[model samples]
Target: MDSSSPAQGAARSADLAALDVRITGCRACPRLVAWREEVAATKRAAFADQTYWGRPVPGFGPPDAPLLVVGLAPAAHGGNRTGRMFTGDRSGDVLYAALHDIGLASRGTSVRADDGLELYGVRVTSPVHCAPPANKPTPGERDTCRPWLVRELGLLRPTLRAVVVLGAFGWQAALPALTEAGWAVPRPRPAFAHGARVTLVRRPEPDAPGTGPASAELFGCFHVSQRNTFTGRLTPAMLRQVLATAAESAGLPTRSPWTS
Candidate 1:
């Protein structure tokens, strides 16, 4: 089953919603705080008239998602302006388009938070919520913002069966957060490589029986940044293969992702 009893599902949904609200208000890192706000205030030339989200961007998708996609962070003008992960960004463009091709998304394009795009059985989040000065978050900043990912994994522990981490940065970041959230990380920790798969485990609790799944698989994929996509380092077919595999691993519905 995709979720637990309706009551339990509702409770978790509420908790996830609450968590997202808290994420938006967080200003834990001073550097990140100044950068995000400064960008929002100065504004990009194309978006000069638009109001920026100017704060942390939270995860987006169903509370009972069976799969999670972890990325590095929000784009300076993308999620930072739109207030939605992957929205108004080139990276988001490739990711969502592949998602739609694999039949996991309602639409292939997402321009704004109000664009009505939706994901089925999948959630997208980042280790760092705030956009960094040069699209890179310091190790200190990543560690500081980790509590949010840890909390999100805890809430989704009941239903999340697999994860697809984009880039080495997210892979490294997510492993620790997942471990902190109750999933076991393999000793010597798995390294990131496109299409790599690792299944993390959880010991069944004798005290609390029948909580959630006992194990979850993690998949690695190249970041869908313009650098990767534009250079064909991560082709659309390659992306479709990884996403389709991860979606099926999570027990989500799927059709063949290839279109001749």
Candidate 2:
């Protein structure tokens, strides 16, 4: 098309290529791979042989986004099937709606990555990349998967103003990384109650490896899983409250951009 178009395309290509490298070669946990593969093979008809991503799903958002949305893990038939965060599922439906209302989503739907959806000023990722059995990941598996999460957050360091954990487990998984980086731990730790905000000032700590004393904030909420969304545990108003708290924690205006 235009001169600048080619350059833009090249930059996008390089970024996606790097994401592919991380996804395809990820072997942080063998059990996760085996379980997902088994699920993929046994449920072949449902997927029409399209194949499962069966790998780590990287976070989706702008590189310099100031906000990070963290989910617990991928959904077996959702992200694992569609190869995108919070896509092809109910959890995604609720999340996207809220995001759109809040002015974070560039689109209303996210059935697939190519669905022309984009996130502005925000990134979405899961602590455990692969879909876990019964949607529950073993502590060992979560531990093994921590390094990638650490690296991803580090890369987004300066711009990562605040993180909104979608569930208790997500908060738990993120705790070690933040602490290791010399960030403050939540007083009572990351519990499942919604709208909790913990802010830590960043400072250099020789004892803390792989993280600077860069201050960060953590927001807690219930997971937007099927159980939570369908059972009314996480209503649109509830999610908005959580988001507002997170934004406020990061010194953003407290008004919600989206309607519940």
Candidate 3:
């Protein structure tokens, strides 16, 4: 749905809230939670008593969105601290600005959820629901979290048009999962880079009763991490180009969210 419409936005917000409620209290990985709690406690004072979300971070976007943006995981002081994907951090600053410029974001500000930020035809989520130590999740932990992503993709079914992986890690994590679920693999299996677009084609018809591919497009690009952006690895122009390709694949205009 487009931002020019109001009713569609309201419906999508409710859908996102439903997903958020389901995992808001999750403690599926005790080790991760314990570590998260410890970090939160240690930083609570330094953070001026800002309480941690300390729970599973949920994906946010339109339920039937054509584009899905996959990120690595929650940052300890970002999503983990603020309870919203890509919020309260430098990484989010880069991401939200690009999204806003691309028309996927309604509000340019992503410092906090209360800022009234909204995603239009795109949805943003991470492979790991919980924040990990030093932002690094173990292989086992990532595997354990795969089911949640599977369920989310299924729920957003039928309308999914393109998938944008925001980093090599996210690409590595999600590509196999999408392949296993029957989506086509990108020709040459795109390596993560700024403005790189790998076209994944899903058949107009269902798999031939047994062995066929699911219908979907897959895109990849370098993440808008602090390291990437601050170091000039991912430039603003590069991010815009990548998003423009993503929107084109999803059959949307690319007027850019930043200009408005």
Candidate 4:
């Protein structure tokens, strides 16, 4: 099937939903599987009575969103417990707050999956779905998890015009996936910096013929981790500035619908 066909795009949208289900069931890496489950079983004192998701976390937001936000992975007690990316953690507090301030999020906090928070023109995902030990996924684990992201980008390609990578890790992971998904990655690859920006032209694939070529932009921002936020290395203003640039590049309204 030509990947660019409307029928195919619809099928891909359904596949993306199916992929989310599959992501929540993945036990691809023995280490990640063990760690996630072990943490779930040993429940933290504060959340001892709650049942943890204890599985890979899936991407959240509209599939046709123009802005895609990529993070490193789920937090051990955060997403691992709440089952939503950037939910139930301090990092999430900072991220959602910034998103709200910039008019991307409907609310300033995301405590649970059913919190009724909504995103405008944006989606959030991660390079590695499963939370890893010490908050770090090994190179082998990252490579093993690449296919899911590759498939996700393929499904999101039509409307995806800009990407906001949270950190260097996400920046590294997204580059290859974008390339595999048909974006012409520049040689020497763009370096990762807090405010880095790169524009790549999409190339039509023989196997997945699309409507000619399209251009997309990539923006870099420091992760909304407590380590960075608490230390003042990544202020909310800084984060909003990068997102504002991305939103403009994606042809989205700079001011959110709810904002003045």
Candidate 5:
């Protein structure tokens, strides 16, 4: 291994850590702030003894990860409760199980922030950091939270090679963020569909460095929400298929779902 690799990795980790801190501290959207706080204070009956994260949830995973999983926003009772994206939620249960089958996740369940879950060459995040009411964030709130995504994209450019966006909302939100982060999104922006795929190239700059990946593949998959999963619109095998493809495109090794 090259001596510079460790140093570079450390620097990237530090940058992302700083970003997460800033993300958790954000209160840019008044309505989201109020709603998340109210939900946190209400204390769900099952979790009354536990403390709530209550603040904006930051993206979870390693800084130099090669794959990105994008979702709509934090769940009011899930991430807003555990301080971790996707944790303590049914959606997270399905997604993580699929990821584990694809060899991108360390475990099949993500129940809490301290659950020892780990992701391999993949990072999970959402367009909006704060949980929204009725599981919907206003378009205005989405726009307000975009800069964080843009910054995260920029930070991950060095190693990022693929992105799997769950749901239309995240797809729409990610395009502008990716563009702002240096990728040249095609004109007539592509529509979102389960199993859809697109390749995005980095916009050329006068002094563009050649040390990092110049392009990233983007895949679309249905969100792992109860509505989709329960209705069989997105099955475990189907979700794993998309994630496996994205993982391979990101240059990460994946295990076949059919294997033990």
Candidate 6:
């Protein structure tokens, strides 16, 4: 499919169910395909007996979320193993805990896709769906995976108003996809920094009625990687502050007082 074709956009804009089916079946990048499968086959010691999802991990959470959380890619033994973004990993532990504390997540831990943990007014996704070798995706691989994200943004345009990008990689990758999906990105784009914010107004499109030029804000946060969390580069308070800000900007309900 032509990444920019109207048909592709229509397909992705259908619904999360359709988009998910396409995402998991993707084998567009040879390197990613081999690496994800290789890791699944070899298996991590602790999860040796568990069956790995071994495919592209789809974004998870409410379909009509007002907020979107974008990450770099799946980890070798994390999302790639569990078929859910951020699941089965330290990074997910940090992220979901904050979301839970802030009232966006139903639970503080996401061990598997069926963990009964639901997100309120929020969704989690990544720039690259498949796990890359050494936790890094080549520029070519990133570009190749761009369409899926672009289409996803298009689908979520109606309600999405705030995006929290984790780390510089997700920030860089998100700009083009947002632009392609019709958000008016600024020239010489705003540099990525912790807590940095940029607002982009959606562009009017004939096919996209009732969705003309709605504004969305982007907020930056340090990746919830073990490297950053363990070093105190990104603390629970720091991440929660960013999420609270983004949620407010999206007009999501205030976090429940009972949440902790």
Can you write out model 6's per-residue Cα lDDT over 1-260, one digit (the tens) per residue? 23233236336547887887778878888899999999999999999999999998989988899999999999999999999999999999999998998888989999998889899999999989999998999988888888889888988888999999999999999999999988999999988999999999888878766762279999999999999999999998899999999999998875644423
Clashes of each: 0, 5, 7, 0, 0, 1
Q: lDDT of each structure?
A: 0.88, 0.71, 0.73, 0.85, 0.88, 0.88
**lDDT tens digits by residue: candidate 2, 1-260:** 11122223223333434543465456557777877777666655657767666555667777776778999888887887777889878899888877876667876678876889987778888778888889999998887666556656655666667888888788888888666544667566656558777786665545544453266778888888878888998898888777766665555544365544
For candidate 2, which ten residues in a row score worst on lDDT?
A: 1-10
Model 6 TM-score, all chains together: 0.93
Off by over 4 Å in 3: 1-19, 44-46, 186-190, 203-214, 257-260
Structure candidate 5, residue pairs in collision: none
lDDT for 240 (candidate 3): 77
- Per-residue error at 13 for model 3, in Å? 17
TM-score of each: 0.93, 0.82, 0.83, 0.91, 0.93, 0.93
List, residue by residue over 86-159, the lDDT tens digit for candidate 4.
Answer: 99999998888878877888999999998999999888999899989999999878877777788788788888
lDDT of 4 at 22: 70
Q: Per-residue alpha-carbon lDDT of model 3 for 3-84, expressed as tens digits?
A: 2222233234434565456555556676788887776777655576787776678898778788888999988888878888
Return model 4's CA RMSD, one decimal: 5.0
The C-alpha stretches of model 4 lying farther than 4 A from their native spots are: 1-14, 207-213, 256-260
| Model 3 poorest 10 in a row by lDDT | 1-10
Model 2 misplaced regions, further than 4 Å:
1-20, 44-46, 186-190, 205-214, 248-260
